[model samples]
Target: MAKQKIVRVDYRLIHGQVVAKWIKYHPVKRIIVADDELKNDEFMCDIYKLAAPGNEVDIISIAELEETLNKKDDDVMIIFKDIKNAKLALNSGVKLIELNVGAVQNGKDSYFVTSGVALSKEEFKDLQEMQEKGLDIYVQPIPENEKLSLESIKNKIK
Candidate 1:
């Protein structure tokens, strides 16, 4: 099976950093935004498409991620809107060895782990679970920043 080149969670999916920086860094032909809501929103879908000028941007529901991966052999990056969807993709059998956490906004019971990342208790737990499952998960908002492991964040919060 052809695996995704990068599996990332970024609330602002297909933004400037993604189009300008990430695609250049990884050189993926296709970028799949796996979000349940965005898949049904045509306007947002078109907006995301336009954001990535040269590459193909596909807005698919998280459930469709595995099937999409199965069909594609191209270098691809899968971006999820939240950690839950990323976890769901893993649970649903999408193969991912590492997860990049980026720019998840403040939500219920959430606290800032970084200026960009805010995780609630449950979200933190889910990340811990993913890490325990042997996934090398880390938070890094951009290519220039250092990737912070679960342990690093945990120590910071303590």
Candidate 2:
């Protein structure tokens, strides 16, 4: 099985920071984006593929992601666009011991945890449950940024 080096929640699945910064720190051989919507959108998938020129980029559904997690042998970085998909992957048996929160676009009822990350009450609850289940969840937009744990952001959640 592939070593799951990083599991990041970024609304912009594969972009500049991922290619120019995160990869510099993690050096992943494969980038698997686990989002049902992206899995069905060929054009968007192609864009992400172009963003990460040399690496193997795959936009797969949550189910296919589970299979990939079970069979692959490379160091992989899994990206989920939303907390729901991340929770789906976790429930599907993807053992993500640590999850990095990047940029999640603001929405109604969402509270800002950081300039880049905001979470709604429901989303915050989901993350809290994940944390309770042994996931070390934190917010770190880039390699240079200090990671802020869920506990630090708890009070900010609306």
Residues 18-130, candidate 2: write the lDDT tens digits: 99999989999999999988888898888889999889987889988878877778899999998899999889887885889888889989998887888999998998888
Query: What local distance difference test score does each model get?
Result: 0.86, 0.88
What lDDT is obtained when candidate 1 is compared to the true structure? Answer: 0.86
Task: State in Å the error of residue 147, model 2.
Answer: 0.7
**Candidate 1 residues 1-158, lDDT tens each?**
44577888999999999988888888888999999999999998999999998898888998887788778678888899899998998888777868999888887678888878998888889999888888889999998899888888885443
Per-candidate TM equals 0.94, 0.96
Model 2 residue 119 distance off true place after TM-score fit, in angstroms: 0.9
Candidate 2 Cα outliers beyond 4 Å, as residue runs: none
lDDT of 2 at 24: 86
Please give me the total number of clashing residue pairs in predicted model 1.
0
Shift of residue 132 alpha carbon in model 1, Å: 1.3
Off by over 4 Å in 1: none
